[model samples]
Target: MTYKGIAISHTILFLIVAAFSVEPWYFLMLSVAQILFVPLVLKLVLKDDHLIYYFVIPAVIAVSILQITEDSRIDSLLALIYLLFTFIVAMVGFKRFINRGFTNIEEFAIDMGMMYLFIGGLWFVASVLEIDTGFTPILTWLTGIHFHYSSFLLPVFIGFLGRVYKPASYPWLTAIILISPLVVAIGITFSTLLEFISVLLYMIGIYGFIVLAIKVTYKNGYQKSLIVTSFGALGVTILFSLLYATGNAFGIFGVTIDFMLKFHGFFNCLIFAFVGIVGWSIWTPPARYKKLQFPISKITGKGTVGEKILDDYHINKTYMGLVDDMSIFVDKESLPPMISNFYEQTMHYRLFSTVHWHAWFKPFAALYRLFSSRLQQLNLPFTSREMEMTGDIVAIEDGRTNTRAWIRKIETSTIFIALYSIHTRDEKTFMNISLPLPWSSMVGILALQEQDGKLLLTSKSALASDAGIYLAFRGTIFKLPLEEQFLLEEENKILTAKHEMRIFSIPFLTINYRILLK
Candidate 1:
């Protein structure tokens, strides 16, 4: 049978079981999810045919058995099978996410939705086996449903909506929506107050999604209406959620779990999930992710060794500035004259740097310095001794992404061979720097700012700035948990600068620079 045919037959069988089952009609909620909603969503987000999805058939059968079975061991084993299917789906999502890298918010949302299904599957298993999950079995089952819809389906829907039209507030709103599921779970497990707060956050994100849905121009009026109705259903159900959360937090008995299951769950599944699935199926928007094709540093594994064996590209060995013109990237009018001049006429300046390794990371730094010195990469002395930096600037003839190689050396030992380039996205320009490593590169996207006559560049920027440190390997880039700040100011006709590096928000190294016209 075709995938669609099987899904329809499985859903029908589950509905029949629910119709005749003695009690626990809520199992019907999970039945539709296992057989229909999840498959449709996987079809949408997954770009290619995956063998893992075939497991969904057995998973459907397992969920069907759970709906009518009274045997404890059988239910547990069946739930385990379903959980394994979800685990496979999650792995597929994780692999997809890694291949694409951290580029688009819409795609990220979709990928995250795929990964979240495993959590839903885990909770489903726990609910069936009667695990001591700190909550009653009913709550546990409800939690599983919560993840399937809110964590999984909602994100996928929002992602598809984003492919159609993304508003300015979409990223922030999506971020809140993405993180709220975990926050809600944390709140439920620990604090009522937290649960209430998370519900409020979720409500804001869902309402924001509704506003965006109205703004998105659909293929036809019917599709738009369906999409709007789907979001609208969530708008109402989220209110129910808020009410329930408020009651639970404050000891109010107005809204109960039973009321939520009957009303909230019904509207969400019928209107939100079913209608939304049909609506998107009418014309699912094309994926927003395009694999980044910008050339990475070909020199890998101790760049000094690889430098001798260059790629099939022209490299003009010359003494040049970091940038031909600072005005091309930022407003030259706002920048300090010395700062602007330094970049435009970089070779005319002499560089000196004092490296400071933070106390907490000195030991690691010392160990790395031993290996790094041999590779002539990021090799800074442990002591805070000022060293003169001398290097040659070479222009790389890459028309797509105009780049330069700035090889800096401290007394004959190569410290950095940073390939500098510029990337413009959404009308904002970023400074892209790549340092070659073993079959990979450390990439830093820096956002520029002029503040109080000083030039401020940071990997961590405010919203709208695609600025972050990342690691690129085999055509895929992923964010690294690191931050770097570079502050430059002109003092007494000389440009002084401080470069601070941190990992997980803890300072590890700093380089103070003094630049003078030679």
Candidate 2:
């Protein structure tokens, strides 16, 4: 119903980020986790895990073997495994780009983050596997850190900043933020002059982000100190990145590992990771505790150009392969009722409400709520607010070849589905996606026919993998996907689905909801 899903392992990425920075024996293991497991954890968040999960299954055993075995040969073998997985996620990001599946800006930036992770992954394999690359072994190790911090984390945080600031309106600045991370990573590998240019670009991107942070805070009634502290750390964070990039290019500045570990490492691991994981977590609005009610009042003035531009985005996502399956099991007259219920029931829990956290976080959460309460008063510009939420499910009809559906709405409710077939490479393949609209996501169901012909439905194709969430914040930017299901019985009633509230496939809460046209 919404892009909002719970991830039990939402903290997995942050934990990996924090754990590896301090450098433990498992640091080598966690570094790989950042890429392989981060995506897996994200799958729990997005609730869309595919074959990629199966590919990384061996990592659990390999990591365990790694703890007991310190042989370089074994390490190389494990790196090889992780290297293959990294390539897979990188390819996922690439294919998404080619298809233009990053429907919005922050989603687009996160895809780029995947590629940078591959860059870091490459260095990680080289250092751990001890491949005979031209660079010194230590440099390979440092390069791994460089890609993780500068190339990987930089873009990811920038993507978050984009959500907070909405950088897409500023075309030139968005272009710089998007392009510099990759160019700098490539430049580091080949040429000094190129790396220098790339670092300058990278610095400029950071500056742009800082400027936006200040503006968003001041205009939006956000707690100024929190934004300042986070971006201020980011400012110094990128400076260390610049120094490292400079030293690598010129081979002159004595930027020792120890020196970097002390200042660069301390600030980035603490400030960058902490602020990103915690600061932004606090900054973003939580899901609404109650349905967001749009009052019927005198119409406001003409909508802005930005609003119209966003409303016109072309989205062509379909699961046509399942048409036959739907035809075989679904009752034709049930569609309108099912759709109506989906439309109304889901709206009750629509976006900007809550981030369910554990009881212990109350004191800290109270402080955050104090800030959030104030910020809500300010009508600061948010990209999500720009897009139109009004939608229509025009018709759901019985057709010769398949059931016809013409629908358009925001996110999962995108009732504006045009006449297009979402072609997949295989019959059962799942698309790697993260929708940009609030309370929106791709919906697919696995339908099975009972002996009596009653249909049973499940959200995922299989229980491919599972994640353990050590943290569940009530209103954290709801991401994780849930293990949910739906059913159809009577023609006029539409569909019967256990609208399960979940994080990381674990149903924390649920409701028996019915969608009906009447």
Candidate 3:
């Protein structure tokens, strides 16, 4: 008999035993069924006398273990014995069938049956174990299908889908396996017969899409763009699902069954599918076109205010330098618009000027004043002319909006500069400047200067108010540096600096610079 035939025979016997539920009678019957398969498998292996003992001795030991073990462990022992017997029988049968070079549907069916029996037997044994199955909690969380046996149903269903569709490539097979958990989770989360039916339909659709994708890929030699686009889409969908789940967990979004039933649970899948199709079209041109060229104009665009802000500070340059050394980094483009808007606002107001003043104003003015007794220490360069007048410089009259007024005060500027030096192959100066501003008031500056280096770029209104100063500063200092770095360049007689500002609700300033060769 073929391996598939042996597998089906074993499955039928196991189901009959399971119907009896690990009783002594069921154990006896299982032993008898396994013994019947052992001799048949041994006879098949005996044709090769050189390996006859190697195969037969193990089978004998397994049979002995099943019959002699009378404890509660006997159920597990019996399951193992059954698996071993079925595997050996199937292996021998498969070898004999392959030698005969069979290519008919019957042989294929037999092979599938054998695989099912092997997997089913192993699953049954695992279910009987008292130790925690790591996946049980996840499965319980997903489907409410608490029965240990039900866990095996998902893999079996997936197997059946694969068998029925007969996918043309490994990627399609992989996708089906990968998406199975998501399908199960959706079904459980929705918790209704209709939702279960919807999951079934979705599986069918996914299987069809995979089959079509595989066909297209085979016809076009595995399009790289399509693969990348598909994976990208899948990634986005997973992220959306995670977000939605988080929202539900926190009682913010209120978990809804309709999301799964009507919209495939998450928005990412549809987005990915659309992208995959578009990417496939781009990667594989029609017959009318001899060659395809991606339009550079379509891929690139004019700089935005946020990009401009990043460019001004040499943020991008710093990023590129650090990216080689660091594993984690942030993308300036991904910053929220509100935050970027605030940064741009801060730049326009020259917050970095205040920062420079905070660092250098007091010490330099004190030293200069000390040398020239005629000079007053308080009359430092760029000190606000209206220092004595301190209240409500800006106000709002609209009744609908909060009637908050900007308050101002002048305090002695203490210059604090700490420097460290390390020997390196090239002489480079790295400077970081920060200033703490009044928590309740907006801060602005008069002017900013870089002594030896050209002002390659200047920030345009970057604002960080009291609410979130730490996050704002860390983000601005760490992320904006890279973009600013890329925008600095020298042309003709003038050195140019470019910067981008991202606004946030906090108090902070960051200035990036690079000196040009004279």
Candidate 1 vs candidate 3: the lDDT winner is 1
lDDT of 1: 0.82
Clashes (backbone N, CA, C under 3 Å), per candidate, total 0, 38, 50
Per residue, candidate 2 scores C-alpha lDDT tens digits across 296-381 of 11111122211222233323432322232233334534444333334234322222211233345445545654443232211111
TM-score for each candidate, following the candidate numbering: 0.77, 0.45, 0.22
- Model 2: which ten-residue window has the lowest total lDDT? 292-301
For 3-69, candidate 3 gives per-residue lDDT tens digits of 3444456455545544544333323322332333333323322333434345434544554454454
- 1-518 per-residue lDDT for model 1 (tens digits): 44466457766876777776644776778778887889877776663576756797789888877677666667777989999999998888788778765556788888899899999999998987889998999999998998899989999999998898886798889989999999999999999999999999998999999999999999899999998999999999988888888888997858977888899767989999999988887788998665554445554553443343235444656546887788866788987788998997899899999999889998899888778877766667777989899987777654436677787887777878787888788787778888777667788888887888898889884443568888888667777768899999998998999999998568999999999999
Judged by whole-model lDDT over C-alpha atoms, candidate 3 comes out at 0.32
Error of 2 at 502 (Å): 45
Roughly what TM-score does model 2 have, to 2 decimal places? 0.45
Preferred candidate (TM-score higher): 2 or 3: 2
| Candidate numbers, best TM-score first, in rank order | 1, 2, 3
Best by TM-score: 1
- Stretches of candidate 3 exceeding 4 Å from the true structure: 2-19, 22-73, 82-126, 134-170, 178-518
